[model samples]
Target: MAEKTTSTVPKGQKSQFAVPYYEISYDKFFQFGVSVDCVVFGYHENRLKILLIKRGAAPFMGMWALPGDLVYPNENIDVAAQRILRDLTGIDNLFMEQTKVYGQVDRHPAGRVITTGYYSLIDIAKHDPHASAWADGVYWMDLNEVPKLAFDHSDILKDALQILQQRVRHQPVGFELLPEKFALADLQALYEAILNESYDKANFRKRILSMNLLISLKENQKDVPHRPARLYKFDKQRYDELIAKGFSFEL
Candidate 1:
């Protein structure tokens, strides 16, 4: 005969049945936690920068790190990402794409926690970051000048950046970081900052103009040290139509 186990219901709770119960203990299952980290890339001063927050809590307190936090038990990963980013950085509603999962057994000092890295690009001048929650301060650091980061965030940033570079090369996602009206020089500089490479001025300008993805605004830079360059805006409507017809954007 199979042995029966006594029900371990709480004192205030009543058992549904009067017979002995057979319960499968869940204690033998592995317990772990999941978290989300955001790598927000922005273009500023003709350089690529990412948002970093100074930690105010333990397990790397006082160190600059990506805005991240533990995921709640009942929360979705994407929702957790948005919530965590808003709670720590005061920015919201930006589209973020998942990049990688860092699951080193000892990555987190607190416990066995796995973190998913998400990345997004934005116009730095548009969204102002305000640190809150466990973040003591928030700032943007140049990609090359980023100091050692907390936890395994450096690896996460690097992987996300690689994906960003690849995506930028194939898609027009870089426009998300540029002003609506911009000079070709501004566009080239943004690309260079992201790809970390320089292109011949004439060649780059000619290639971009030939694509017909830019609409001449008949406007020029108002105040500048150099000759005023004609401004153009990304022809997003045309781009969408072309993409529907199987046209791919290639840089």
Candidate 2:
């Protein structure tokens, strides 16, 4: 049996990978730290708000930044993001989807550090997000009022807000920010707030009501100076039934 020779390159083609390959000591190579930051969005008072904390320690100390910290060596990226959100907002089991990775050479003051950004949407009235002692202040600032943030957080916030705007228009996640019982006007207000635009009352109601996903409640709004509006609740069961029957949702 003669020895066989093999090449990944095709017989008729030249190998473009002519460059040599070598390995160096892993510890001697340039290394970077990884962290997770969260853009926690809350919808309240008919305005979209994002949670921000005043940095307590050095390296942009006293400046506002997205809630975050360095990822531990043993932690999964999702768990790290959850930890960041949990520590900042005291909410557990959040679906903190990774939005983007930021790795500019000079983004962080702490040498080479890259951060994974995540965003969360929640109802503000239901949960009062608080800041730890480390943070001098914590507030749900309206998106329009977002100030210059620490590090590249301002950019992260910009991208996350854009994602929220797009996702809400096409998904049922917007219902998560609303109470179990709501009015047609309430839903429209939410959409307008997120999309930063208004919808014609007649068209918006006709289209949404056509879906038949709302359960009209007998109760009406109270304690209002204006005429009370009829309340309705999202029928998740109906939505699921429609989905199973190959009906897709769209705005």
Candidate 3:
């Protein structure tokens, strides 16, 4: 039998090889840039504080912005958020959750960029002061007295705050911001801080204690000049069990 040769060209084409019709230049290809912005919320000194950093580069130089940066080419969104948080705030393993995506074309002054905002709750005492000082500017601003932020950060903070308020009503996220062994008063104060309003102490205690989510430490508050209040800790195991049984905490 004779050997058969197959043409490498498409049907009806005269040439055995096809020539490239159009070329795509690397520079002309659309680039989809991504970034992660963290809305770090912490409750300290009876006030809610948010982490912010001063812009060190152009487009918003010297202006206050949320602690964030471009997502590294080799990093995932969540990892990028964690890395940014650690770099900006010096805190790790904090309670962080993805909140929303902001894709306004003009959100970034330097270029078109899409951002994923993450809300994190952390105990202020756990932050490392030295690491936080590495940024061009790092400060914990009182949530109530926040100044105008660079870019769309103000909007992002507002959205995160609203979500935090809603989550506190039904979830136990507040525990992450408060001290490990806290008092009923501490819990009430945390709620008040987030809601920006005061609540009746007696009523707040009655409601929260009724849920049985707190574990009495059988110890009193330490280092206070006045009479020490009873200390308590959140019962995660019990909370989880209750939540699994369709229990919800609503204040």
Candidate 4:
């Protein structure tokens, strides 16, 4: 029998033929598996930290790694990422964005595997993480103190951090890593921690205030050493309205 072909034609148009399935090769493509890695960043104790898992399986068993897993054959990659993150970290419903893809031929020893990296920021105090699935243990570590990771995860993490740093300068994403109501000093500290640099206090405060994204809560910090500072909250409603009117947020 001749190889099978498929076609679709519009009214009064000639049919266009698609190459026969048997004429194309899929064996090489089938050999590779797709996976996702999560780079979950949080701010605590005036430092930037990342969530990591202690692996329980081979190919780097007992080593520290970003929570990750292979995608099921029928699963959507984005859904797979969310599932793997929740399965390993016990934190769900947090927004995450794709950072990059790692596809070196030898990145995985067990087989040919490619992985996409995802990153998200969260308030460390809001949720507690427990290890599950292939993760024997899970905890937060200071970004500056991260250990050598399994696979190419170290590279994946570095790229994610760079993306986070760039994003904070152009968006309000860093606020996700802070408390809902925070002092201006706390906000500045969080930004410094992520960027690994200090900003001039006067200029930084002026620029941030001029953006009109923060609402003074008419509240002050309580139970703190030295003089208490004023507290503010991000005005998300105003931000949405401004965005609709073509306002650009930049640091």
Candidate 5:
């Protein structure tokens, strides 16, 4: 015999077949958000430094972390990184490069956010220290003394450092952290700082000068007791022309 199921309703209740109060869809299952993190590196006093900010918001409030924020819905990731840097450091025209994307499911506490990390090199003395509202409390910490950072920032920094080391060897990126005019020794020292090792001075100079990328300036280092070294400036016009002609700046 076939069993019959009966629907029941109370006297004061609405009908069982009334309109549904809610709806669900399978199409909304795989949504995620995006964000940008800036690994800001600064060179000063012969030490490599990174910019860190004390969080003023929740999910890591009061904790030291890399400067970052959620990306606006209509903005691109690189633009978001630049915006975050401008807001946090009041500095612009930075040499920024995309490093990596962090997408661990639990990487963020508030929700599932995939953050694209970008690294920038800035001359500490050239930038305005009071640009960001949070800049007052922000600080430049020695790279060796980086504290426990929020999220996987430590890993991000490690990767960025490796990229920086490689970039320094084959590119003219060190000039970005230096003054407009620099001595060969200063340029070599900057390279050594990034490489974390001593390089042969003669060989270094030979390689750097052989590229014919610098414009020798008539000025010399001043205010020093020892013999002054001649100053030189990077020739961007020549560099661009060489680069356009398939010239590689390899060490």
Candidate 6:
């Protein structure tokens, strides 16, 4: 018999170069990469808060662990926890649901190609979810006190925070739901119901009106079963101007 030919090989490894290769169907389109991160927010004592943790390891060691990792890849359940809240309001795009994705393979030399972060709202005074072992000292940092975090997280957090700050006003379509002029009592009830908590009525009014986003019309609620309350309406001109200049009607 004739000897078989060798296309290529190491000096002594005759068969090493002969391995067959097969082309799999549609294998090129499988570049799908998915990751989930979250911005967990809560409200307590009229101050907005978010959950954060100190990194106890490298890549961002001693810095904040950010909203794109640390609570993902291993958190396989309880994501349904937010669904209850979602269904309660029957609203979509409630909070950062894949609203933005950081997709750049080289984003992390560590290995992920694509990433996404979701945001959720909660009552801060209630639960305390623990962070990963690599994350130490999990704390509810006041939104106003959020320190510089690791990675591009600061930008992500800032954007998500802005959405909620603005959304709380327009969502539940509150401003539109109110009549042109409304009583302070009705307005306070609107906020309390939406926020799922009570606010000190006097303080709530003071803080909300202090923004100067509302106009006190020279009118009062008419034909109410109770004492007539003052009336006010959202100032379209003022609201538009402040929003253009980065104003937030945080409740």
Residue-level lDDT tens digits of model 4 in 133-247:
8899998999989999999999999999999888766566445666789988988888889889888888879887998889999889999987999999889876665545654
What ordering of candidates by TM-score runs from best to worst?
1, 4, 2, 3, 5, 6
Native-structure RMSD, model 6: 13.4
Off by over 4 Å in 5: 1-30, 93-95, 131-136, 241-251
lDDT of 1 at 116: 97
Per-residue lDDT tens digits for candidate 6, residues 129-171, read: 6554356556777777788887667766877766655567554
Clashes of each: 0, 0, 0, 0, 0, 0
Q: TM-score of model 5 relative to the true fold?
A: 0.79
lDDT by residue (tens digit), candidate 3, 64-85: 8888888988898898888887
In model 2, where do residues sit more than 4 Å from their true spots? 1-25, 28-30, 240-251
What are the per-residue Cα lDDT tens digits for candidate 2 across 3-112? 44333555665544553333344453337799999998888978889889989887999899999888998899899988777776576687776788998878988788
RMSD of each: 9.1, 6.5, 9.5, 7.1, 11.0, 13.4
The stretch of ten residues in a row with the least summed lDDT in candidate 3 is 16-25
Each prediction's TM-score versus the true structure:
0.85, 0.83, 0.79, 0.84, 0.79, 0.48
Candidate number that wins on lDDT, 1 or 6: 1
Per-residue lDDT, model 2, residue 247, is 42
Candidate 5 clash pair list: none
Q: Can you write out model 5's per-residue Cα lDDT over 1-251, one digit (the tens) per residue?
A: 33444445556667536633323343433367888888988888667889888877777777888888888988987788888877876766676899999998789988889999899777778765443655335788889899999888889999999987776655565556778888898888887777787778888889889988898999999997889999999888876656456444344
Name the candidate, 2 or 5, with the larger lDDT value.
Answer: 2
Candidate 4, residue 28: Cα displacement in angstroms equals 2.0
lDDT of 5: 0.78
